[model samples]
Target: MSYMDFPSFSLVGSFYTDPSTMDNDPSHYDESCTNPSPWQDPGGSHFFSFQDILASKPNRAFTPPVVTCAFDQNGNPSLTDPLIGAPVNSTDTPGATNGQTPPFSPAKMVDLDVYQQGVSNIYGFVLKLTVGGTVLTGAMDPCTLNSIRFDRVLPTRGWAGWDSYGWGSFGGDSNACGVYQSVVRIPADTWPAASGSPILDQLRAATTQDTSGNLLLSIRMTLDGYQNVPWHASDFRIGRVLATVGPQLATDPSHCLAGRWLAGRSAGPGDAWDQPSLYGAPFEVKNNTVAIDLSNALMTSAPGQGPLNLGNLSVYIGDGSTGVVGTPFQTNDILYSLSGGIVRLPLTAEQAAAAASAPFFLASSLPGINGLSTFNKQPVLWQESATGFWIACDDRNFQLASDQPNPGSQPGFFYVTQWGQPVTDASQIEHHVFPCFPNNSAATVPWSGGYKGNSLSSDGCLEAVLCPGTHSGQFCLELSAIWDPGSRTPELESQLYFICLWQKGTPPPPPNLESGCPPQEQMMSAVVWSSYQINTKPDWAEIQRLMKVYVKLFPSMHARMDLSDQQTFQIFSTNPPWFVSYANMPGPATYTLPSGGVIASGTIPYYMTRTIDDPRLMPIMRDLSPNRLLTVLYYCYNLQQETQPTPPPPGEGAPHPTATPTRKGANA
Candidate 1:
């Protein structure tokens, strides 16, 4: 509906003469109350008060464009007043009980009787009380002993009249008295002629007089008591009529009826509560605080070839701008306006490419350890070997045998043929199997064989073997090329040999030659060296420094190694002076070798006691010594035993464990 052609009030024939004109003359009782006498008083009697008129004769008493007041019947004044000298028991009183004495004493006098009489006479012309089609007579004014008898007049039309009252006659002067007031009770015909007719029909015909004395038919309405008006009709419209005739307090806009022209529909899913949609269209209405879901909209004519092409296309809607277009898609793909509206764009090749190629990489580090060390310090290496070549050596002392008769007999090692191990030459051994031992036991050993010393150099061949120890049941081998310092040439290098065993028997054969191998070199520049003593562990700072250097060499590899010694507890009944010394000595000792490299040793002194038979100390010695003694035995065998002196017997000058100090070569 365009504003210019909007319907007007008169188009539907909803016009009527002012309500004031209807009640202009009250003297002509037989005619409709279209014109009441101007000299009549509009106040003084209860009828002059619109409230009393409504209470006395409710329903259609007053027509459209009527002023009304609400009154309480409970507060009505008495008809007789003994204090006023009006006969308290007089049967002549209009409302008195027949032949009965009044409730109050006759000696007292009340002024209300006179006052009510004056009000009734002055307002008699304007007020009318009706019951059904007939008007009652001799109805005593409840406010006084005065009698109010109406001329048996029946209203022909629906109530239509005016009201007036004289204050001077009722003992109040012009200043306090109201005069020349008019009211018109219009017939129900003045209502809307049709369902959708203009709402001003009853208002225009029934009431008149504006606050500015404009003489327009618009009524100054002030809504008060409950009037049985229809739901569609607004209280404001009714109030305007009353306000035009009398003073009225302005009402808040929110309190006004929800008119169609005043407010649009409430916010909802498809309403303008959100920003208007702007897609292949031109302009858009903006609205903040709204949300939109544009998952499945299509843009066909964009910078791409597909029918649902979403490509480079500048679109703006409600403070939002989109550079790319999207084709028919789900809620996620649909473009949303800045203010909150969904829009679809055509699909383009660029968008397709963007969706296809997303940069992602699989990144991982060594498991178990944390921080950067797991990534930087753990070493990973690959290798190649020749057939028949034994890649590892398993010493008999470090291996377990079923029987003691062959305790020293070697159980042979295996070749590396699995997990990235390849045999390229005739001397390259493909596979070899051997018994396994506990990984943590001193007897457990890794696969170790190198073709009998210089044979590796002569035959130009390589072999690998695995010894799966009992404790750790997995075998791992890594080999890398080491660079020759003088020739700057790469040669086959042994990186590491790891063996874990599940049972006592031989391990399975290695994989075929198709397995990959590491690059061959003389000496590997990158290597991770880590060691921990029985009592001392590397702190984070030391680990970090080592990790820094390790990362630089093996920029892309992880290297890790953990080492521990068996724990030993020694107790003495008579504490030795150097008990702390022996215990402290057991902690791992780190030192810088002559080669400018670092090494750690797991060794400690055995403290001696005068009373070695203490029962508590016995079990402690037993539990803490067995594994430690085994480790010491292995160390002694490897380095050629050079015993440390026994500790001096308490106060006896016996040799102390530290009495003897032995030093072995670098190999030890």
Candidate 2:
């Protein structure tokens, strides 16, 4: 008594009966059953079985990484640090001395790679046994249920006209490969259709690589009552590999642009250039910084995909310094207007968002090579190359502002700006004020007290000068660095130059009711300083000889002038001299000479005291159209000297007495 009868073994019965059915069905065709049937098990029950040969989300992430961190200053684990703040000396360990600084602060790194979980829905099978009239434990207990089929397949793949190849691979994107959905009528089976139920509830596929790195796809099937089954929707709707492509790059522009960069500490009328050049054009230096006008680099339709996103774009500065040696400076791109080509980029500084809303030099305390404080400013040439997925577009001179440079050494500021001269291979300009001009140090680093009441007696030699100003004059310090086209050497030799000078106004008597004073005493202060640093000490004999001929001729050097300390080569002069009391003229007064010795006091008449060594200063009666000469504003004042009970030694700034006759008072 074999279970399957000959008549039942034909079409439907043969399709229904397989070794899988026999293995999954317990007590199949048992003779001791209450109802003698070949389809019934030993307990007069039937069995239901489902098998899946495959299962996939092509773009799904299998896992998100977990992170570990140390306690921050705030001690809150959840409050993540943005990691873009001023650096702290992390090397400041326990009991470290004050003001201790670490060698460097290395940037933190992050893992950007993701391990793609390869596909895995190979095969799966489900089997359940049940009596025709018996109730099962629950819906989850599929081991004892009646035979069932989908009401109507969903995720509907349409194959109405064709009978041959019905599968379609249609949803591929950059991140992952698409699915192969097929619509084939389930082979006419003996199982009954479970109508009104979610026949095709959901379908998903995933992709991964095997030990050999061959990609495998996986998918799962789900219905209303029975919600999960392993069925891959690969190109075969089974676990299979995916085909992918790699990436490429872009190049530089031959004829891209040109413009000026206008930035620095001093950028106004008659000052250094306010707009510096971008396409290697020549501009002027202002406040130790250079600005290039990139208005020409402006474009409506960006070269690449879309409008330039400055947040995603990195800025580089290409000076003559690093491009020849690699390692260009990576500056922060300030802003690229969404609608215009006005791209403004600031160099060398960081944590820009945290900086206060003041000028860079005023807001920050970082110092350049000069002892005076300065913010980062490195002039550069903008290149146009790309590295991997990003663009490499800047070359910089690191000598200007390196990480831990010598205290007073200026950063290398090699640019290709022509000062009305020919450009060469080593065509360079190193300046403190931007575009490229050596700084006028006196105004930049004003003396502790004003220059008017100061002395040359301070420990070091001081170089000072006077420039014409609105009222009196301004004392300025000058650095001598020649602009040499042949080489990049410091201008260290002696040279002759002139500086316009100024003098303080007369100090009023008690109650100090001085007001409405006009511009006074416009003159030239001759400067003679030695920059010869040939040895550890200066050559006093050679220096003093040159200085004495010019400077000792003036009254400022009445005290000893020593250039032994190379640091103090500066020769200061201003008039009517510092540390002198100006006297008030009390009109014309008559006085009698004394038989006994007694110095008499007399009022010097008020009149313009003019001295002309050269005939070039001719006063024009009227304004000339293009005036070759400047009409200097003249202020009038009377010169009156106060009598000192005890005069300074004749060697110490006392004027040599003149034998001219004058009125003397009679006291004896």
Candidate 3:
């Protein structure tokens, strides 16, 4: 959707038509209402939705829309002094409440009611209640409004007709004169760019005020309890506009943060409220704030960069140009680079608008927590639009772990809340108690992996139900891989669960075992491969033994491994064969000898048969040993143990125990 389509209201600075004073229209009354109206509206001319009109709070009285106030012969609005229990259409006080008191009271002091709840992606208002007052000058929390209410109303069928489409409620301490600034959140793409753009000054200027700086007649009456305003209040001054950068806010303090709301995707498999998906924790970005601190937000790490860490991020703002070759992707308006983990954005109105309406991204040159380092450019995938940015899961080489049979089979990429390990038992998997986003329905994929299909199916979008869970005793795969890096060393660790496994049901069984070695021989080959095998051609008997061993491990691995079209291992092949690590093998890699002289890189393949004939391999043979084959894997496991993220403190129960008899090999 175009950024201009965002949902927002511009102030004309007018007062709302009083609901209590409106004439009765029975056709607009909902049948479920305690008291239905008597008249029918054949043309649907009634302003408010029947249900909304009928569902007035018990503390408030319901009224219908009618021409209670019309232009006088002189074209002035008919006026009346404030009077308690005044009647509508009263000859003496026309358009007054029809013997029913309005919910507001002018005598009571009216102040902006600020809710301090956490932020969210839902569209909301942040009005500057009072310019300089102690209570009014602060920012109103947009996260307070729980939900939006939409109703159809036609007021003159013009600009005013756009006024009261959505309604929302906040349950908390509120006085008769307290004014709430509720947000009617729509999807970020549908919301008006003004919601987060530099249109605040223009909107604030649009509001009409009296000579003494007080609001005009209509707003004064509404705030004074003469009328109850429904829908977007055009005259309200929006507070410093803020939006989220990711799909959701983390509510648990132990994991990321709580009470700091971010607005992003409300639909998708990863949008579980309690267990935030691995797209990372959502964070806030506000307009006109000059500098933004992203150390606490999820903006640091991009796809392939691995998990974020302090002092490693570089921030960039898109220049509002279609990305093309030879064109600069980033804007020079970034006055300050990331320092102390904060990025200073352009402060001017025009620059800020261009920056927000275009793409915004973060890049880091440092190696990620996974220990993989790359020299390729990390592309920008997010646009800091009016409300929030979008995030797409990059499954790397592990597409089968997603709901799709392969990449591109469906829409959205799956986001794993837990990775690298299995949940172990059914009871250990945390269930989404309130809602579950439907699989394959996502906005966009920020970065490309193997996922190529883009079918935004409206049908299976956001589903609110109990998510699927695994039954006890079911086996799941946890595949790990080494990404394409500039270099791979024994000091670096391999990424575990590079593709999160499908953990919701019984794992698919291994392929049928081919004619091969006996069980005892198979066990020996498996032990050799895991503990001592080097990258070399094995004997014919050993090849059969390895095949037999793979039979035990391939089932779990087949669904989790991202390989070429070939589904089976190449154990019998004479070409470069697979091993835990090729470090001890000779290949394109250059090596420095113990004498401090470097061995020029080899052009020959690394397998025992392939490299034995290459004269350049003579020097490296001195370093080759059965023990060297295990060193790389041993160090990788050690680094993984040292770098594991600290487990969150125990909750209400004992931590789940890990299961045994883990799967092995390419396929079993």
Q: Who wins the TM-score comparison?
A: 3
List TM-score per model, in order: 0.14, 0.14, 0.19
Ranking by TM-score: 3, 2, 1
Tens digits of per-residue lDDT, candidate 3, 1-668, equal 00001111111111122111111221112223323332211111111110122233343332321112222212122223111111211011001123432121111010010010111111111122211111111111122111111111111222222221111121111101111122211222222323322222232233233333332111100011112333223211111111111111111111111111222111123222221111122223334323332322322122111122322333444443322212222211121111212233333455455444443444334332221122235322222333222211211111111111111121111122221111234333221111101121111111122221212221121221222223212222222111111101121111111111222332321211112111110010000011123323233333333223112222222232211222222211212212222323322322222223222211111221122222222111112222232232232222223343223223613212221111112111
lDDT of 2 by residue, 38-76 (tens): 211111101111211111446321111111111121212
| lDDT leader | 3
User: lDDT of candidate 3?
Assistant: 0.21
Candidate 2 residue spans exceeding 4 A from truth: 1-260, 264-413, 417-668
Q: Supply the TM-score for candidate 2.
A: 0.14
- lDDT agreement with native, every candidate: 0.19, 0.17, 0.21
Per-residue lDDT tens digits for candidate 1, residues 186-240, read 2223222332212222222323333432212211111112212222122201111
Lowest lDDT 10-residue stretch of candidate 2: 6-15
- Model 2 sits at a Cα RMSD from the real structure of 44.1
User: What does each candidate score in C-alpha RMSD?
Assistant: 50.7, 44.1, 33.0
